[model samples]
Target: MDDGFIAKPLGRRQIDQAYPLVCAIAPGLGVDQWRAFAAALLGTAPKGSGPGSSGPPAEAGIITVQNALGYMHGLFSYRVEPNLRHGRVLSVDNFVVLDLFDLAGIAETLLRAMDLLARRLGCAAIHTTLPERYLVRDSRRNPIPDCFRTEGHRQETIRFSKDLAVVNDNAPAVAGGLHGVE
Candidate 1:
């Protein structure tokens, strides 16, 4: 029987073990901050009060994949929400691999695990918010791997930014009275 890649809820030990890999991907994060974030994701509130400290911890999920050597290949975190459009959806917030150049089947395995998790949770869809530059695309214009079909996307919001302090002659002014400075 081919039981899929080993995945389970992240405990404190696993969180500690996984922090270094996470830091490699996202630098400048202190261990304390990572601990707090991991705690929140695991539904274990921190000792102090803060915005995330209150409110029943969101339905968050984290899964880490290990290679044959027992080293981590990648991990992903998501939150489950009741969606009016899709009934229920799993919103993937973080999907990290040690190195994209050498995925070594990690991406495929992890994504399949995510699919199983979504189905187990009764989620109708899986959504992710990756930046445009990081989006993976093949020649066929598929951003996702062939294991799953890609659904077209709709723009949910328009992001606008203005420089309130820069008043240089080269800057342009907009109707909102904010300067557009590079």
Candidate 2:
């Protein structure tokens, strides 16, 4: 069944309505911070100032889907990044859906929005970082990856480690370590 939800780009004037949803996702952040985030994302500056005249250049935007009750149920923030490997890439971040709902549908709708934004911006690929909570526990996680897989994206696990202590002379260096002999 459709949830009677509609998705679209969020604007600066809608911050008051959006803040509660933002708080639902990140309770620790203050309301003032949310206001700043909305401004930064929507690329709005104080009156009489030029674009980005307030601070850093706008690098993100929020896409939100609200239900028939006019309550936002899905929220996703995406940014365009120049990547050496993927040219201009769109990175989806800080995605949140109300816990009581099925996330798969909301996620799909949001990704579709992200894809359109990416295409419009000439992005070559889309990337996102999923938290461990979603990755490990949510039943919705399966469909989440499937959404990307259907679009030809592949998943890879990358691991990195460093020894902070001074190395002992007796320890043999790995092939790419500082002590490696060419």
Candidate 3:
């Protein structure tokens, strides 16, 4: 079943084609916004220069799962970053899988691909926070966690975030502290 699908790095040329899948995951996102975000992930300039343009580090990219006929069913964006505790870690986000026919297989394939990419990049670990929508405790609609467990991945943390009030960009740094020292 997994053989019918191919997991490949999403290229700059296919950004437009991949937008729909991205929209499925983020409904309110605009086309321009999606294009720019995808371009950054692909390490290509938002306009003019093509796929190989230097933007983000080479270790970061978006991967998509496509069927034999070339339909994108899912995707995830990832970047390798230095971590104080882990040395270097591969962090993935925007994981989406649209093919319900073989959700388990697709999820497994994506996870395996991430593991291989992490190893290739010499990462100490692979970290990803499944989107909040996927954590609703409904097993019927979410099988990704099960796939992760089957692949030997354990849930190490539950993340919590509280949005801070916006701060002025030109606000003066506080005096006599590390905030302004750097």
Give the winner by lDDT.
Answer: 3
Q: What local lDDT does model 3 show for residue 105?
A: 80
Q: Mind giving the per-residue lDDT tens digits that candidate 1 earns over 81-174?
A: 8877888987775666564544535556666666766666678887765433345554554333433343233445444535465645454667
Give the winner by TM-score: 2 or 3: 3
Q: What is the C-alpha lDDT profile of model 2 across 12-31, one tens digit per residue?
A: 67887888776765777788
> TM-score-based ranking, best first?
3, 2, 1
Alpha carbon lDDT of each predicted model: 0.60, 0.66, 0.77
| Sequence-dependent TM-score of model 2 | 0.67
lDDT of 2 at 47: 37
Q: Which numbered prediction scores highest in TM-score against the true structure?
A: 3
Candidate 1: segments with Cα more than 4 A from true spot? 1-5, 44-58, 99-104, 131-133, 136-182
Q: Count the backbone clashes (under 3 Å) in each candidate.
A: 0, 0, 0
Model 1 lDDT on a 0 to 1 scale: 0.60
Off by over 4 Å in 2: 1-3, 44-59, 137-153, 157-182
Q: Model 3 over residues 1-182: C-alpha lDDT tens digits?
A: 47888777787789999888877778878999999898877763233221223322347788778888988888888888898878999899989888768888888778877887777678899998787767756436568787888899898889885534544454456777555566
Native-to-model Cα distance after best TM-score fit, residue 128 in candidate 2, in Å: 1.0
For model 3 the local lDDT of residue 109 reads: 75
